[model samples]
Target: MLHPEIQAKARAELEGVIGLDDNGHIPRLPDFEDRPKTPYLEYILLETTRWAPLSPLGVPHASTNADEYKGYYIPAGATVFANAYAMSRDERYYSSPEEFNPDRYIPVSEGGRGEPHPEGPFGFGRRVCPGQHLAMAGVWICIATLLATMELKCPVDEEGKELRPTVGFSDGLSGVPDAFGCRMVVREEAMELLGL
Candidate 1:
């Protein structure tokens, strides 16, 4: 809701793939195989994770062998927590770390920066989240369906002004955002497809 431009761009990408009928009716919602045609969808997913990581402090990891590199003392066994939030916002890697821009994830060959995805969000090495792939697939499908069927907008007041929700997050292992109101209006094409 906060980023209509991004949504519109993604919608355009979808239309280019799925297309519309002569009466401008939606043919059908997108499927998993259409993922490649709409690369922006992946970018949006990546941007969401990069902007606000689910787990700010990644799962605690134990150091098998400790050593001093930055002049710190060495320890045999140590508990280390990677700061994913900090890593995502590193200015050296991100052009404007604070901005929620999805284009950063595009590959360099495609004229994008080819920036690396935030690794700490999932985890490192053999300890990575097992359901990461499934989670991405499910979320992508849900998002694509919604984008195809409806237009997401912020809830508005009677005064004709947008009621921007206070962006607050629950602090914990997973920093889930607090409730925010949005208005999802069914698209004209989708309504027509449903024989409305």
Candidate 2:
């Protein structure tokens, strides 16, 4: 069940925009255009993707033939793995790289690169994720609705260690956070007209 406290925060944000709480029965479901106004949710979506990247190591690529990349000779049939996780955490690309803060994606200007480091590690050139648009849309919608009407909070146990998420993962294809518990709350009024 969603936690009430988190819900309150989301609801507050919603009310600030939507002005009513009809049990989340808003005028319409969220969409892409709502992104600018619902910027926080966008950050949440990107952060979620960064936090638990779909693939720790992105799709593997093989060198088709002998070629010189930079100064090194890469022979044919060489296997390569792109570390999305590492890129996301690179200090050159991110500030406070180890923290789980999601505000990195929020744009600093009208047409500028936003926070959360815009340099994507989704694979290079043609090998990039084929479903990038679909994936982003799914993530955006899910996050939008959540931020629109729900809150997420970390849960603590009796010892109060703040239960760190598992560092290692089983999937050789990707790196993912280990199992951890957190509280999710539904906000009473976290939606708005948006005028989109």
Candidate 3:
């Protein structure tokens, strides 16, 4: 379950841009048309995906049969993987990859002028993520609603230092970040808007 604070925050943001049809009644949920009005929401999606990739190493690409290309011999059943983590962190692609800077996605132009390569996270070719649009839209809505109302705070230890959360991962066919913790705070007005 989401922290109450987080839920409240999302409600607040949703109420604002969702707007009223002049009848004092809540309108339908946000849509793409409302995207221009809520840029930060989209940034949240990009940041989340970048911070925790769907696949640390993208789906493996394999050769169907033995062949030679670029003077390299290919054997059938050869295991391959595209490094999603490296691609995301490439100095050529992102500036200050270590820092969590959502501003990197602020640009609306094609490929995010700031990104080293003009490509979004879904990837390329016939093997690209089939659900890119659906995933992006889902993330966009969730983030937009969340930021609209709540404030996220990092948990701190007794030493008065913010918790340094780490992504625990295992070596295997799939890589996933381990569990971590954080704090959430929701303001009063935000909750009222969300109707929570």
Clashes of each: 0, 18, 4
Worst 10 residues of 2 by lDDT: 1-10
lDDT of 1 by residue, 102-193 (tens): 98988999999988877777877799899989988998999999999999998999997999777778988899899899899998989977
Top-scoring candidate (lDDT): 1
Candidate 2 structure quality by residue, lDDT tens digits, 1-196: 2234434444454445544445554554456666566555555556656666778778888989988867988889998777787787778767777665555665778553465543454666876768787888877777666656556766768987555444545677755546767766544343344432
TM-score of 2: 0.68
Candidate 1 vs 2: which has more TM-score: 1
Per-residue lDDT, model 3, residue 194, is 66
Where is model 3 poorest over a 10-residue stretch in terms of lDDT? 1-10
lDDT of 3 by residue, 1-83 (tens): 12334344445556667865454545454666777766545555566567557677777788788888689888998976667
Q: Cα lDDT of all candidates, in order?
A: 0.88, 0.61, 0.63
Per-residue lDDT value at 132 in model 1: 89
RMSD of 1: 1.8
TM accuracy, model 1: 0.91
Query: Which pairs, if any, clash in model 3?
Result: 9-149, 9-150, 10-145, 13-148
Return the candidate ranking by lDDT, descending. 1, 3, 2
